[model samples]
Target: MYKFASTASIAAPSAQLTLSGSGVFIFQIGSALGTSLNSQIVLVNGALPQCVFWLIGSSAVLGSGCKFQGILMASASIGFMDGASLVGAAYAQNAAVTLINSVITVPPACNL
Candidate 1:
């Protein structure tokens, strides 16, 4: 239902984030053009746990497939509280990223 990649910034000192409320946000690489078709904020510019994230250009939030029955797409400057909430949260993935706790997963699919 959506596709694209962008370089998101989430400020400094802060280290955590929450892509909840139903959405899909990632920081792979490249501009967020032609890739943002349906997203609340197709191109996220938030901190990454231990990095500095900032709004270098736009901040009006861009997207097409944003609001829906089941779709969360945005990034927010967060802290450790958001990260701790991840613990004990159900996970699922046909693939692996790191260890058991570092894999990409959706929060309990619907709840936790």
Candidate 2:
């Protein structure tokens, strides 16, 4: 049987970008931001759609992004910021996906 645990914070950001578009292209695209942090989600092994984690909660969207506009119809990892974007149903054998964002905001004290 599978167990539920803190299972490392994926630490990997699914998507990060400097906004630059219209409506959402203006303010949100210029400097708006949002984030997703899931806790104790489901993780499975073997086969596609292997891990089934649900969107527990998300930071409000301040941009005119594609929340209700329906994502670009597909089954892969859509990086459009839609609530339905797929990060992974990732297989165990596939190469690791590395996401490195240089603009990380560390707390002031952590700047030591």
Candidate 3:
């Protein structure tokens, strides 16, 4: 499990990120606490088409027009900006989920 007790963002325009297996990536709001500036996972190339993002923050924000794949689980609210799309599921445990012109497609249920 990867834990971050402060604000974190995957804002690298040219970076690749893949979270899989039983691993959990946790994020807790830091200096920018109590605002909409929670943890952010930006869209970028080179990322795996199928994975998971476990956000343990006050909130989770997806970049606009992002094409992301995986099961995104957040501890609080989840915001999907305009044009952002997800090829998986998203769960917000303790707050309302807001989406603006976003797409969410759940993969076909199957067992290996």
Top TM-score prediction, candidate number = 3
Candidate 2 local accuracy as lDDT? 0.21
Candidate 3 TM-score over all chains jointly: 0.61
Superposed on all Cα atoms, the candidates' RMSDs to the truth, in angstroms, are 14.2, 18.5, 5.8
lDDT of 1 by residue, 1-112 (tens): 2222455433223222344333333333232211132222121343122121222111212222221111212223111121122221221122211122122223233221
Residue 33 of model 1, lDDT score: 18
Q: Model 3, 1-112: lDDT tens per residue?
A: 4556776555654233444443333434431112121223342443332344455456767766665666666778777877777777788888877889988888753232
- Predicted structure 1: lDDT: 0.24
Residue 84 lDDT in model 2?
28
Off by over 4 Å in 1: 1-5, 15-96, 100-107
Tell me the whole-model lDDT of each prediction, alpha carbons only.
0.24, 0.21, 0.57
| Cα misplacement distance, residue 52 of candidate 2 (Å) | 5.1
Q: Whose TM-score is higher: candidate 1's or candidate 2's?
A: 1
Could you give candidate 2's per-residue lDDT for residues 1-112 as a string of tens digits? 1122322122224323222222211111112123343211221232112122222112122111211121112112212232222323211122221222211111111111
